[model samples]
Target: MLKKIDQAALFLEKNQQVFRCPFCHEAMKAKDKTLFCSNRHRFDLSKKGTLYFLKQHVKTEYDQKMFQHRRALILNGMYDPLIALLAEKCQGERVLDVGCGEGSFLHLLEQQATLLPSVGFDLSKEGVYLASDYNQKHFFCVADLTNLPFNKGTFSTILNIFSPSNYQEFARVSQSNGQVIKVVPRSGYLKELRQAFFPEDLAKQHYSNEAVIAKFQETFPKMERKIVTYTFEIPENCQHSLLEMSPLEWSVTKERKEFLQKNLLSRITIDLEVLIGRFSADNMKNM
Candidate 1:
């Protein structure tokens, strides 16, 4: 399955220009059609219609089962409002999704704007495989955030949703007028799971709002932040994936999982904060 996907990805790279090397962050040159660096580093485009730019191997916490769970929850309309909000806010011809798992948001964006061209990347090869299967038209690749394998100023807009941020890399690839939309979990994002696992410490050490704001401020000077909160009734059948996609999955004891399964509620809250910012070269002085 992976080999087939890689083949398809290589086919898609035919007309694409050699941008930056995902490993050394150096400029890449086109040898025939494949991208190669002076350091003798070579990365071939997959035949399946995507790029394979992952040079340094790193284990990802996400897996097929976790992404499958996330797909179920997202398709359940739990985050539809957030998706709509993102679709409305983003404006550009080309959009890149960093840490885009399974291309759910890309699917949502396609539904909203069929004309928009989008690309998604993730560290997890499994996730990229699934994303390519989900949508063959839009490009999906197994790439890293810290060292994106694209040319500088190639993207008009970039998105990081419930994922890590590499601001320097983001700034390097994004156009001067481009915007970076970051979706973060707000307070009580997964309250039910927290309730089940950390009942004893209900009020302590939640997802930090201050930290998110400070981090965004540190990265971009001129930015706007919006908080979005919504309630969804999670069905009994969907509880497993919802739990699996969360950190609570790792922290929960076996007994707690059983407990959550047995007493899972049909409703939960999906709260998020969308931080939208435009890069300003002058902003670097603030740092």
Candidate 2:
């Protein structure tokens, strides 16, 4: 079997055409484990096996521990339904997961479907580290969504799963006949956790997607939103991971977090809207 580094290096080499220099915004190619541009701006793959393609390194609360738990939750099949739906909706084999934390969803989808050139990018190096160091079956790099380092019209499909994205960038990088699938959380997504964190705050307990929907409709003339609401059963051992992985827990008091950790909740809601976007022919050229 190829070593993880070799595998990762090869993957990067195969798709280097899509990568561009963060400094000069020019095409980049892999050169002995380093990505180089015509301008000589370079980026070396780290020991963790991820290339930092962002203009500047970013720091976020998304750390290794959170990715670990998120990985476990995905493995436990908590999001299998969502995965199945994504697999069905995904149009092309060349898929890019923006904000792909820990490589769980992309890796799993690759298994479910014969997706070639499955690539994952995240702004958080910690998340990319967890993904790269753990497995090298696919591409995982530290890249910001706002300033994606990709050639124009590269990907046939772009996936933004509960992550920040620049719609204009998505339109620019995606092929003329491409699909943009974005998963945004609905009001009841992790309802129990929301209640646990802010039990008394009625406004905090509820969520809405009206504005988000309007924006998606505005961005993609041909768009569809599918509401995915289901209750998932997470084993006792894995419940703690769910708590640790979610940003919703960030605001919770330490006491509440600790309390919820001990008294595990076996079932949780997985409410989200999967928005599928396809740009119109008229807007494609302008975009």
Candidate 3:
């Protein structure tokens, strides 16, 4: 019988044709604990049982502590409705999560038996480690989105949620008829937090998705966007994470951070737009 790690590895092996060396852009073969290419460039399998496919080191505010808090919120069902919608629209034998943070979202889908083979990749080692440690049913990797390691037309569906996206890379790795699902924040997202952080700066309380939407529209030929907004009552104990889980709080001062950390939000607004679409004619020209 195969261990969970091997099972996940088998998923990679089955799709090895789509994987390439980050250094040389050559085909990579999966061995026991590493992936090697003809050019002799190699990548190691992490101790956490996931792969590391990056060409360089990464620096970011998304450390282990931050990912821990975000994972906690996700496990608590903070994004259940959104996840449900994603799972429903996502139909494919294999699913690839681009910029998948901490792996909570995909892990939850695996628990709910909504995935065939879920593979998650993020630039943050901390996030990928959290995901790999939390669940063994799916494959997680530390990867760079700008130059993905997968071959042309690898995944039937790709997901980009609350993370940066590279349309060109996405198109190169996705199947000819692949679907891309992207979630962008609306102005009211975390309105309570905005209000608390900037009590006086009225402009700081709102956000806009105009540029993001337009970019997505330009990237994909056929696309539609939907607005999902609601006021979710916050549990008293969960308020700390609700504030800390967002990157928006990274710029906050120590004094303000302590205040928000101690205080609780009664209700938080969840405003977001879900963009479901396909690659444009120009992108599909690669097919």
Candidate 4:
């Protein structure tokens, strides 16, 4: 079997047309385990077959451990319904997962549908690094959403799952006829944890995706929305991971964390809105 780096090189060589230099916006070619642009810019793939597109390191609020917990929670089927919905909506020719943390969504999406060329990128190197280990077939990269390192009209589906979005860049990189699927949280999402962590604060206990949904609809006027809401029973071993997986607990007081750490919730609320649509022809024209 080929090493991870070799696999990535082979994939890039065949599909180099999808990529663009982040700095110069020039087309790039893959050779010698590196990507080279016409402007003499080069990006070398890491030993693990991951690429780093950021010029400087970014400090994310979550660390490698948090991502590990997130992956564990996902593997335990916390978001299986959401994943299934996403799989159903994805066109899957050349899919790009923007802000794909740990690459679990992309990996599972491919498993559900026929395998296709897939790429996932995140601003956190830790997250992207963990993502690379999820599947050798998928390309994982540390990249900025605002300055995606891909040519225009490259992907058939763009996934923005519970992550930040750059609609303009998303529209720019997507095929004119392609679809963009975005998942945003609903008010009842993680309400159990929120109620536990922020009992005194009502605002923090509830979420509102109205602003996010409005923005997504504004960008893709023809979008369709699906609400996936359910209660996932937390397994004994996954309790801690579920608690630690989200950023909701980041700012909680030490006493509360310690208490919750000891008394984990029995179930979690998975409330999300999955929006699917195409970037209008006018949007593409503007791009």
Best candidate (score: lDDT)? 4
lDDT of 1 at 58: 65
Q: Give RMSD to native, each candidate.
A: 3.2, 1.6, 2.2, 1.2
The 10 consecutive residues of candidate 3 with the worst lDDT sum are 109-118
Give the winner by TM-score: 1 or 2.
Answer: 2
* Model 2 ranges with Cα > 4 A deviation: 133-135
The candidate scoring highest on TM-score is 4
Model 1: CA > 4 A from native? 1-15, 24-40, 45-50, 203-205, 284-287
Which tens-of-lDDT digit does each residue in 1-287 have in candidate 4?
78888988988998889899999999999999999899999999998888998888889986899999999888888888888877777744678988888888888788787657889998888888888776677798999988999999888898888888888898889887888888888889888999999999998997687988898888878889898999999989999887788888788999999998888898988888889888778867765
Candidate 1 least-lDDT 10 residues: 9-18
Give the C-alpha miss distance for residue 206 in model 2, angstroms. Answer: 1.1
The Cα error of candidate 1 at residue 105, in Å, is: 1.4
| Span of ten consecutive residues with least summed lDDT in model 4 | 85-94
Order the candidates by lDDT, highest first: 4, 2, 3, 1
lDDT of each: 0.74, 0.82, 0.79, 0.86
On the 0 to 100 scale, the lDDT of residue 90 in model 2 is: 68
Per-residue CA lDDT of model 1 for 100-202, tens digit only, reads 8888888877677643556789988778777776555567878877778888887878888988888888877787767889998878787766776777875
* TM-score on alpha carbons, each prediction: 0.86, 0.95, 0.92, 0.97
Give the Å error, residue 29, model 2: 2.3
